[model samples]
Target: MNKPFSDKLRAVEPYTPGEQSKNNDIIKLNANENPYPPSPKVIEAIKGFEAEKLCLYPSSSAYALTEALAQYHGLDVNQVFVGNGSDEVIALSYLAFFNSDKPIFFPDITYSFYPVWCRLFNVPYETKSVDKNFIINPKDYYSANGGVILPNPNAPTGISEGRGFIEDILDHNRDVIVIIDEAYVDFGGYSAIELINKYDNLIVVQTFSKSRSLAGMRIGAAFGSAELISLLKAVKNCYNSYPIDSVAIAAGVASVEDDAYFKNTINKVIRTRERFSQELKGLGFTVFPSHSNFVFASKPDVNAKSLFEAAKKENIYIRYFDLPRIDNFLRITIGTDEQMDIFLNFIKRYLSSLSGC
Candidate 1:
């Protein structure tokens, strides 16, 4: 523990991830993970793996996975890049695009890791504020120097901006490499994969974690013109040559092959999200229109922190943040209808108890 670290890391506040509690049989809704397990094809893929393959190294470029994923998304192999996770993909973007002179820019309340990545690389960055309603206006980003990166259905709020609006920003800021992190896009948001043909500066990052139910497997990807992919390859070649392992490549290839499973899971999450939002609104909580798998809600009387604590006492787990505007809001991941019913039952009990108190 006495090893001296770089001075750049001294003041770095790394990201605080969602809790992974095993204390009780709670209706867990904290992280925005899929309520269901991954597709059977993914498991089957792993089951069919050869035992002797472990003796050899995984393909440095993960060629099989890259080809499968590229075909699944209708893109060329040269235009796609895969990594350990979209987090790493974003990290590479900073390495490829960011400079201390031209500050990178992202929404003030976006994926907290954006700033963390900047600090990790000693890259200066600026934060553009989202409006009072928590919507990202593309025009607000025109002034930033280095580039911009943001989630579509922005985290902790689940609000999404339209494709036309994003294209407008691309129109004006043609020089900057705009990275769209679409970790939760399948739930409802539009995919910028469609626009990559037109905008060479756009880099869309996606993950198998959220929608594909592979958080433990760690496979994320990015797509853009071949030029950008080559820059990412240069960085990837210098950093760690083998960012993906054998098992992950197999699971990732199978995950995309079973398109039916992805569609079914997305439908279920969307349905449950709507049901949860209506129920919360009926109970006097203000629910935002969520384009992601989670709903952002806040009641007038009970604060987010109190609600989080009360739910914990009842063996129900949801997410609550103490940051700026989101301090009062709770981010509840959409689970199965049965699982959510358990959570709602506990919440109803909490409200009843408060009335009597």
Candidate 2:
């Protein structure tokens, strides 16, 4: 009796985050975390934060930060909902929008958190398959349902479905909520924030974890019509009233103000990705067209599993998924130019030893 978990949970496959190691010498490129540090202004803001404020309860509304987010996105404060991270915002979405009778629909290959949310909340859900190239066809999500959520540049795949594809879904699915998880949009995809004014059904969730380099602070946000934001706010109030803490709020406000930081960082990542993809092609690997900060690569000549093991031996680690259709591919995050240079040299030497290479 002590060992048995909830029946719903038994069916759920929990998300496996990338490996974080205490070994400092390893060149880690598994998760799509930003390779750079936070903006200088963000560091200054956090360092200047009042120490005595820690004893006080943070503002429940996070009004100042919400307004900063609103000003940045050209939205009103009521249209923005700040949370601990994009994960919390997603959890609230399920509670506020989903019912047991209706199912949450998403691309079969998407952010792994989608299915976990449904299982945790006891919400029914179904997966819709992506196209052969791992691109999401908009028509697959047109069915009448409880709700839907998919990342713009979907995780692991690093492919994006543009604003028009999302708008097409909004035109028909106006009754239920639609969540566009823009966790990686800062680098590749155009934002759907403009559609929020026209479509009350749409919700666009963003995170500072990727672009702003604030993964440790856990700052995430969502944008929707005032009516929908109110529901998320309600659920959040009941769960954790102070999800946005004092330090995080201070850091978040600074991140939005420093627009040049993202522009520079994203531009660098894009340049590195272009060169990296070209190099991979020369190495006989098929690198998927990517807009995000990582590349999903596959080569028929080499075994993907063996390559992953070999990299670990070289003290370098990248992501390898055991899922259907993509088990042979490696999702490699774009690291610094120096890091990539090291990776490339080591990999080339290893490739020469392989029978195919």
Candidate 3:
């Protein structure tokens, strides 16, 4: 029998997201979601939204959300492009700018979506290995390539590099598009949005999911020079004329306007993350210094898979990757202080049981 799918589709492997459990009783620290709720204004916006607007088509450009993001980042309206999420924005970017014969470059253990998008788009790519500590070396990215995309305060590891490091990479790759995925930058990492005006080829992509508590809303944007942003808009319009609906637009705009609440929630998560990392270290876990909302850690004597199973049995969910170089590691999102305390207690009891003490 002949297979219906094309060879390209057959060869491609998709990106697997973190497990989403339906049980309300479970402490889910797996997906790096903001444990906080959306801003009060967001709630107000949704409640006050006109139900009659559902029959009408939303703004094809997602103008309101794009304008809010532009104003938030101190960029012009032409310099911002909005999408359903940062993932869509990035996938469109891969289509818009990464058509060169040369292979693109990204860190080996960075966001797993980079390679998936490459295969999906048929874009040739190469992975540059991060150092033993899982830190990206700017020198490795200096080589000639199609383009560059990396998550600042990288996923899984949650380690971040500063502006100077990004500048070094940007200074070298002037000809190719450099996308700085800042989905987790609101937690602690410095943003490349500030440098967008300086580099024509740079595009800084961000999501409202992690920091704005709008993962359900699915709003994301990219900031770049008007020329690059226009290209992304072209690609986006070709695929989905109205990626963001009116409700999401209202919610995203409200989330951006409430600066105080955003900062307050971010600070709370940062404090919790720091305290959690310290607690993990005290438990003999080798914890990576994190700038994102999560910490990546490993304990030499404990099996990560076994620990993950143990936590799952207790209704505590964290991320465990069964991939190379990080098979022993666990990526735990920073939940509320109370939640962290509960998880810490669970860890303590689990370790105690292991020793029969």
* Highest-TM-score candidate: 3
Per-residue CA lDDT of candidate 2, range 117-220, in tens? Answer: 88778889999998888988788878888888888888888898776888888886888888999998988787899999999989999999987889999989
Q: How close is candidate 1 to the true structure, as a TM-score?
A: 0.96
Question: In terms of lDDT, which candidate is strongest?
Answer: 3
Model 1 residue 70 CA deviation (Å) reads 1.2
Q: Rank the candidates by TM-score, best first.
A: 3, 1, 2
lDDT: worst 10-residue window of model 1 = 1-10
What ranges in model 3 sit over 4 Å off?
Answer: 1-11
Cα lDDT listed for each candidate: 0.88, 0.88, 0.93
The TM-score values for the models, in the order shown, are 0.96, 0.95, 0.98
Q: What is the lDDT of residue 342 in candidate 2?
A: 84
**Candidate 1: tens digits of C-alpha lDDT, residues 57-124:** 89988999989978988999989999999999889889997764888878998888888888888888
The alpha-carbon deviation from the true structure for residue 137 of candidate 1, after best TM-score superposition, in angstroms, is: 1.7
Model 2 TM: 0.95
